[model samples]
Target: MTKKTKSLVVVMAVTAMMLAACSGNGNNNGEQATAKPEATGNTNGNAGADKQEEPVTIKVLAQFGRADLTENEKAFFQKVNEALNIDFQLVIPPSSGYAEQLQLTLISGDVPDVVFFPSEQDEMFINAVRDGAVIPINSYLENSENLKNYSYEHSWEALKTMRDDNIYGVPRTSITRNDGFMVRKDWLDKLSIEIPADNEVTLDQFNEILRAFTFDDPDQDGKQDTYGVGSYVDANKVLLPVLVSELGHYGWQKSTDGSYPFMLPEYDAQSDVYKNILLYTQKLYAEGILDPDSPLNDSAAASERFKQGVTGVIRGFAGHVNAQEKVLKEIDPQAELTYLFVKGPEGKVQGTGYGTGIWGVWAVTAESEHPEKAIQAFDYMLSEEGWDYLYNGIEGVDYKLVNNEKVYNPDISRGIATSIMRRHNAPEFFLDPTKFTKEELDRVSPWVDKAVATVVTSMDKGYVPPAAREPQYMDYKLTWDELTTKIMLGDLPIDQLDKARADWYKNGGEQYLKEMNEYIQSLEN
Candidate 1:
């Protein structure tokens, strides 16, 4: 079979298996799959399970991508069941409706023992902490050497606290450069365009490249159906550094004084730099340089366009590169992609405020029967040994270490539904480098290095709106949306941008700035 055909076959098999697995649903019995060490007389002395303590059952409220466990997943549970003297009744909410389900559960006062606050559940977590719905684990954490060590590498200080000074949650970190731009390198080669130095293209060179992509038929099919770029307004904010530099701050500007940029005169929408971005986007829309449907399309739509080879340039997280390449390669084996940093006049700059350093957090609810056991279980899970077991499967079964690099079993690597491997942590965790192969390590090395460098760069250049200013940010965002829509539709002239800025300050902008700085001062003092 052809390579493409083989990939399809493998994907189909994985899909079918996944369907079968999900279809065979069960209650939270996986937690009870293991017999007690005393009953089974199985005392191998795993690092996680302290054989001395009698097993305790704990309920966990976790986010699940889907319901039901694959055979491999079942095995993973069975292993954990034996390793730890804890019975875990996993309450998994459907991935699609997790937020709504969790919200309703919270409203009903049915918070579980150990609640997982994934990235999507941030707001809910904050409210829970504020309302005293979750128990604070600060004292427990101080005693956990493993969790404490893991916390140091991530944004534990910020993540642990809410409005209060006490630590309320344990953070999970996924450390990697999540954003970058990529182009169809095959198209560049086919069109005889020289790849720019250091994979950085100047604005003029990039425009030329886009022009060729749009008009010169770089795909060589003699059809004028291709678009130069695939971008939505959200992606544009990142892919176009000029806009990011001027209007980049989420809401609050970089200020030790906590000054709000939106409320300031100099950073108003009518400013020269800000106007350039607006006009440039308008120009792109008018000249067919940008995706015609970009304003209306969402990220998934743009991704579909790229997959169908309708666009040559796209921006996304670095981890998405492999997924994009896989899809594009399936369409045309010759299709090749490469990362690029498009440089504006100011030089190459990545989008700031990409993340809050914490993916999600874990908190214990007062309702948990055994809060200590729940915390202990989670503490162990974040340890080096537990991380290895949870991230990889059984050492010799699901993966093998060759020269200190982990090689996953074929079934796991091919996306088969299995219990022996998982990447999700109930509360918090980070990627383990020792589990990566040489090729995987090399592919992600640049992104990893760039992630570290960008942290420092972003500290000086990035603008993160203080959490206290979320409401003000929302109001400003609503106004900007209206203004952007008007500007794009030509209903409002470009010169009227100044009026919009003035109107923003008149509408709670001043109050927002004053309150924001006050909150910042309170935190600092």
Candidate 2:
């Protein structure tokens, strides 16, 4: 039998065994095998009067992007302590080494009370659940309306898929927004290139603009130094933003075959969409319109190149336009940016979707003395008063209310405030009117709105197939990276992608498809 058929057979056999086991155990209701501990103290409120008398110390291990906490971050923690009446022993390692630190912590059997996992699909997290190192928070989640209501349903479903149908973590919510190409409006005006009225450009128009930007001296610098586009390689492949305008999809697409409901559009058997994207990119590279250093650049390097005026166009986040413009203007006062919505060959203007609306997850460890307090702390972060502090920071310290309008303190650092604890995935939080002046809002709002409106989410977003974690799958990913990069750089012919696709099936791709579809089917049933 083919690998795909074998995978389906294995899935069916496993499902049958699971059914038989449930029938024999008289526990077919899909409940946890071990009885979960009842959450202690008041579940609705933060820290109750009785609990405040004897403060509970909850240790929290989280990922902080920076090396150390800023003064505002310290104050934010102090505020949380006063409100919650919980002594939070925070273990904030730098984000660069956090995964390694987390692995070490798990291996040492010294896991914190509340652990923050950067990814829900982390193998360590899976093993921790299997080893009973992390406790299921379903009982606590049932009582915490703020936690449950604010978090996306898909996030809970994703966590449930990891272990039985039990939520093991509190989702650190993130707003699902799109990113698109930000072009130099100054350059466009200098070259007298008129974009479409709706800001969406056709593929042919896009190519011409790139040529103009590269060859027509759009910067008016009298130098042939600038490229048309700036991009970086992520995971040894060209960044998605650079190709999404052509491909129309980010990662996975709903399969034409019902047996395997999801397929990676890049390796899809029915179409040459991915190959066409590579050829387009190759043409740009050959014509010197695409950045030469793109294969060597990371996200930071690519952004820097754009900011320093090395390139006229680069992929940018919708919400970060104002900040990016500020940086660009610092170098050249006349520099201006505008977002572009490129109409794909399929006649669609689209941007990639962020799956599950979750950036990270917070799980309570079984070693905790007060799992209930940890849950309460997380729930509090989602509350109005708590979210206000997390999002806006201390009212007087971070911002002052003047005529019922928030006036932010310019000196205070608000970098780590909203993300240090948990986040609520509200678009209003990111696009807060109070944070920007009228001029900035008028300039940035349209792009943000456009991006949000054009997002195309994947069909199999939150589901992780079992075969994905296999060594063969990882090997296939490496092979994919190498082959795609080489093809884009013109080192290999376009037809080589066919070999990569075939290699993918040989190396766990067939099983990956079967397992993901089965999981998706189970959800539907």
Candidate 3:
């Protein structure tokens, strides 16, 4: 292999080996991105090159991207203050009011230095760019000395997406694409179990495995202390969980071969896929695998179960396993956790975030002291060094580079993320793919490979119509959150699922699909 190739391999190997050592930082916010960077990523007295002069307090607007800062974040930032000379007066708003609040603030003509958004409000931002509501970040990419050396992957898609004159705000791509990873590896070890080497298993066999984990005394507690399987989130968060537990068990997409066509049961305002999934969920509850109280449990309670060791087998995507394993180690220290990915019918499972192949497209208002300065700042965010610090956190504190790539310390620092979900608002997480590094890719490769391998062996995963996801179509999805878990986790019989599906179709389901097909066709046009 080439030296570059060999070096990449070593970096990945080191990260994989040390994954257990680095439990991981949990975001105070509910979700988004891979992992936020720690404030002062200073390791071994070197945080890469020196930063430029620190400016006065920059009034920055941090959209409600994360929950809040932990004590660790504060400590790291305190250290940062020692070196840098700027106060990042962050403006964090609630998710519900993020766009509205931003608009209100802008109308008052009092915008922050940095304008952040989680999911892009493309329409408003586009108009803002036209009206000069945002400061362009082009110059920053070239001039900002502090951010010029930032490392990590920053895809072109992200870079281009966050621009108007093709020059706009900085894009801090969140790491949300990695999902459907990790299972109870420690449990597997305790049971002296070996995973299905093939990665592909029929729904029935997958069910049996979950039952084995839940029913069998793998832990040897004697009593029927384990559940066959479990689910999380009152609604959609739990979808991926079931997908993980059962692997190729029950799903809407069908096939024994070829690509799983995106078959979202044509949202027949009469036969919607959303309700169909819900009905099957109810069946899972009837079978005694799903947690009934999942709907009522707050984020803290739900996450605590996995962290404290009450739930042995659980599933989530992206950083879920990494973070969970970290908590497990702290709880018991020797906790052995594994993320055995699930397979679909067509056997094409992947443990990355659903591809949002779009640029972030941040705009600047015409009214600003340094419109070019704003663009320059954003450009810095997109630079190699800017992304490196953002992705890896303040250098030595978070990682050290033996090779050209980043080698994390398991304790990768993300000073941006807070400790509590509702306490402080974090606005910097805007996920764009261009910012990923080969090291990051290598680090998560094994689990992702397993996911793909599972798909290879599974039947098929037909595409679910994207219409059910569009804003207009989503409005029709009545079986959301609380109601969804209530029905799915209850003792609903499997036989009634068909009628429920039909009922959903009658309730705005068909319109959802019509809108979807129209939208899809328009894209082609």
Candidate 4:
């Protein structure tokens, strides 16, 4: 064997040994085995006793957002056992350390029966498939009605693109919705600026409003303390709202040619979209229209500034408007917020679209003795009975139904109850009108309904190519972020963007683009 193959074998052996040493009876948590009722025999005089089949035990390695499951979650699992006749042995590590733990578990050569992958493009997931650790679920999916029906079509397409046109995972679905800018309607009225009809504004009109909010003293405070907009860097370290607007889409831009079918809008050779984004941000910063501390601010801080009435506009989900307005009204009772959807250069309203509408995926491992049963457990979660338990929690314990309305128990905490899996096929799945009174719905539905109705979903929302995870590619991204931030803050000239673009190609971007396009072509085929 070659030296590389020998080395890999040795590493695998060591990982297996380590995993064996760490694992004890395959239960990560010190919970007891799930309880089952005794099977009753026939009371009549029968020749033989009736035997009941034992519940299949499926070991699951999932990531929980919190430290551990709550009592309610444990109860939920019991309900699953009663209905599906399956025992779920869940091994959830801390979410912060889950990625590393997952890598270790996969390399150990003794994987869980069912594993949750946060991203379909996760390197370990791809490697596991290449090594035959994970099995394709296309055949099983054909029979799983709830799983197929509840999940988005794009989610299946995304999974097919991951490797060899095979569906390997059941998607944990999320609502496909876009957030836009929310401005203070009271401030607009105060400035005598007429609110745009249909809550839509042209880019020029939007800029004019920003200038007015900044210089015209819309808040009517004697001092020049207010700014036009609150801004902050997203997880990727890019300034948001403006970035989303300037790019006209999220992630990759679909290309016309077969050779380069998908292009990162920021790195497009033919367009200045990215450069213009930086220039516009710099102008906002120089003119004192954007929050001065934006670079150092996170989402929470920016949102807090908006609530404190320090900024007139902030980016937010439509559902959050009611809460934000409540907070703002505490300071100024007249404060009112409304959603704003601006027309992009193409003369259509644009917002960042979440790709495939999947938050995570659940894959049955090849090591599973009952792969079909494992998938059945997931399908059960999407069923009306299971989803009701997941979404609303135990009917009596978490909430009570009175006059066909759910009145939640104030003491119970079901924070992110559906973290393990979600089923958000429609806006109602997210907003859940049943949970709100008519007055509450009246306050929220206008903004949320409009946001959903007018949203222009991106062409490519959740396509993460394998090349995107490479070390060299990651380094280039960091450099790009740093350069973009510097230019926007005027620490570096806008011309430095050229250098950043050139550095991207030199640092494996050319290869990244080639691989991404190839994958896109594969999806087309």
Candidate 5:
């Protein structure tokens, strides 16, 4: 159980099954119904003609999005040209600095063949559409055999909202992150407490178990040292379902009236939800049952609490299963942890997907003389060969599937080391779940729960599409995030909840609702 012993064990990556990606250009999650005139329109933006033989290098204008890829990344890029016989000069910057860069590029009349954009509330993309900086790609849809098929097979509603009659770029699809409670099972056995069904314990019931685990001295140290829950406020943990639920609304829950939009209180707090969340917070606050500093702690701090045997419950997404097991094993050599799906206030469960934002978008610049090559390059990314190349660098170099499950070619590690921006799991980006085989999913799953649970498929997964972005509505999102944090932290008077809702209306919350209504109704049409 020493750090030395833990460091010696090579923790494998999370099971690779759940990695999931996009609809098409004009498939923005924005709220709107941009009408289109069918696919038979005239030649728009120089659609392709079969295959072009010219080997011209097209320059792409990508947003500040692509990773600061490590050596593994460079190898993967090389593989694209080696396998697909296509070359592209990807023009991507950092995602954090992308918006400002995109603006300057647009003004300069230099646009990428494809740019990563949110169908909802992305200012740069909207402005580009208004100024004709981006091609209305709906007409281009007809020429795309792969895209047309992908669009029809999947729901087209999201794509429809992003554009009128032209598809601009491809819409990024996402995976619904199916995750749950991260409890150290070895400790549970020590305490002889039954592991709840798929770890689905009710709020009160979960607290009872956590309290026993923490205070009853399950560790047998005979000290009043353990806490019920372990959590942190770091970026990754902030988006987690458990932390998300505590604040209100991480998973998209629907309302009875279907009139009010579902919101994670932090991301989208409904008035009623916020009021109810107070009761839970009040309970934890009063019982001294929760970690007092969870609000300030980051993921590592919270996880450390669990490792130190100071807290019982550690909630996180599915991917953490493997890592959690690895870390906690140092505490108890037999530590085992599994996914626990989160139950909402109503006791119903919901999961989140890969955001339809920057992570999934990749682009080629308009500056390229060979725009056709850019499309081809992107299409190659969607191909099985391209995906495999991305997942692991050039075969026999970065990795080799000895028995089917990929094992890195030890030599590849010499030239490159793994880090945040790059890893062997890169292929999940374009691997089509529709085409995903059980073996493939097992090989590339992002979360450990993929084997135990099937991800829920949904056409309406809180995506508002491109036309959904309105100035007033965006303000509502901003204000809601700001105020909800204040309310959760007890900075705002609890009674101010109603006033906040009204203020929402005054500050265009009402218009936002109306806009959402129109988009929802459009689903019917």
Candidate 6:
């Protein structure tokens, strides 16, 4: 069978077994476990509430971004063993197929004692809760003051429930900032163009700049080879900064009456908002201002193309500015880069980003023989001392405080230190505050303030898809991708969006709207 077919088969087989396997396990139901003694007797930290004679070994399903563990990871785990007095047997699976793998493993009664999900909102996490694969840890968390203080209240609130008003997991905090655009400041200066203020590019100016970048040989190379913009995986991510400035938030337009414009049939063709965005995209594609390989390019390829001076402006996060600058300097020492927070029609820069909430959560599993001990171990890791170790590694070895500033050790490889730091699967939430200090920020990218300001000013506009209509959302996503790709490629006329909308509704949009609207109502009630 084909790979896709095999994945579907695996999912189906596991799902069928889940209901039967989960129902018999009373421990998996969101219930508080019986009081148990601690594995470590160490109350100095949040290791355990009670006392124990021996160390506890817990199997953990870690949702790692990459498949393999490095030497740094091994060293980090050794430290974890020493600090927490807990042995962790981690099940590391390739992140791409983790959801399917997790389901299959759980259904087969081979689930680990604990599982670290990439996101609390992930469909697999919800299913795991509903299917009784994981137990809620509300009682256990109540025992730890450190875990409570370190956790973001918003993240805790957002991730606690799975339709039963019970806590299922411990959420990691994260910062959400919508992606921004970066351009070569030196190129703008060379062309005698005034740099637009942070997040303040008018459509007219934006187009003009692209034309200059495309035709003016901004790189000072004799050949007119550079494009205005390079490759991006999705149109929404790269173009939303420009579009949301003129129009409101893309995709669903929420009204004051709690209605969604995209869901209503009247706005399907009448609004023409989606069509207009496409037309603009097509214009750039035809004019050779957009990267020709955009439809096929990944973020890495896009960044590489940008570094090679193949494009002048690309959409990315604040960190991309630092990474791109580092590489671009190697190629052309004189190259200078600046980040832009594209302004809306009203001259206000709106940013859509995540707050202090991560996609991953640490959860104790129903099958765990030592559930309370598992919670204690996780809580300990979130303690101040534990967090310090997880975030920086051995103070003088991996990193050190220089003049009261936490600086990475010059001798240690950055890659190794980073790998070690992420060994515990506790994701860093805010990139600026968690990773970058003020002095480091000033040295790395001074324009980050503009982006940060934009993000802070427009925090209310950030959007995440509703989880109520997840299945329908997936179906609609597939249809939307096919429809948008065809329109952008000129294979289908822009006017065909009306037909596309009808197809979407038939596919899943109608049910998605119904379910999402119902969910919104439920939240209000």
Q: Which model scores highest in lDDT?
A: 2
Per residue, candidate 5 scores C-alpha lDDT tens digits across 1-525 of: 533213211110010111111212221111111111122323222224222343344444443324344465566555444433344444444344445445555565544445565443365665655665655444444544544343222233443335344445554434334455677666577778775555565666666677787667767778878777765554632312234453344443445444464333322343465566654554564466677777778878877887776777777655445656667777777666654544556675654442332223333334435555555555555455554454445556666667786566543442211111111123353332333455555633544444224333332434553333667656565675566555555567666667667777676666555555555555545
lDDT, model 1, position 414: 15
Candidate 6, superposed: residue stretches over 4 Å from native: 1-53, 65-111, 118-127, 143-162, 172-174, 196-200, 233-246, 250-253, 256-273, 353-358, 380-384, 401-407, 411-440, 443-480, 489-494
Over all chains combined, what TM-score does candidate 6 have?
Answer: 0.71
lDDT of 6 by residue, 1-525 (tens): 544335434543554455436444322211111112234434445343223445566766665555344444445554556555666556544455456556676676546678777677677787888888889877777786666775555565556556556788876545444456788888998999895444467678878888999999898879989999875665443322124424434323344344452233223555655577677777788788888877777777887888888989987766656667868999989888877655654567665444434547777888777887676666666666766665556656566677987776544442322321122223232233344656556644534444544543122122243542467657666667777766765667887788777777676666666665554444445
- Number of clashing pairs, model 4? 1
Off by over 4 Å in 4: 1-52, 65-79, 96-111, 160-162, 235-237, 241-243, 246-251, 256-261, 329-334, 354-356, 392-394, 413-417, 432-437, 449-461, 464-475, 491-503
Clashes of each: 4, 0, 95, 1, 54, 17
What are the root-mean-square deviations of the candidates from the true structure over C-alphas? 9.3, 12.3, 13.6, 7.1, 13.4, 9.1
lDDT of 4: 0.72
lDDT per residue as tens, model 3, 82-129 = 333334344444454455555555565545555554433365665565
lDDT of 6: 0.60
The lDDT per prediction is 0.58, 0.72, 0.45, 0.72, 0.49, 0.60
- By TM-score, who's the top model here? 2
TM-score of each: 0.75, 0.81, 0.57, 0.80, 0.66, 0.71
Rank the candidate models, highest TM-score first. Answer: 2, 4, 1, 6, 5, 3
TM-score, prediction 4: 0.80
Compared with the true structure, model 1 gives a TM-score of 0.75
lDDT tens string, model 4, 276-358? 87788888898999989788788999988988888998877878777778889999999998888777778876665657777
lDDT of 1 by residue, 15-96 (tens): 3445447657533321212222343447244445666676776766566555565555555555555656776556554554
| Local accuracy of candidate 2 as per-residue lDDT tens digits, 465-499 | 76988987987788788888888888999999889
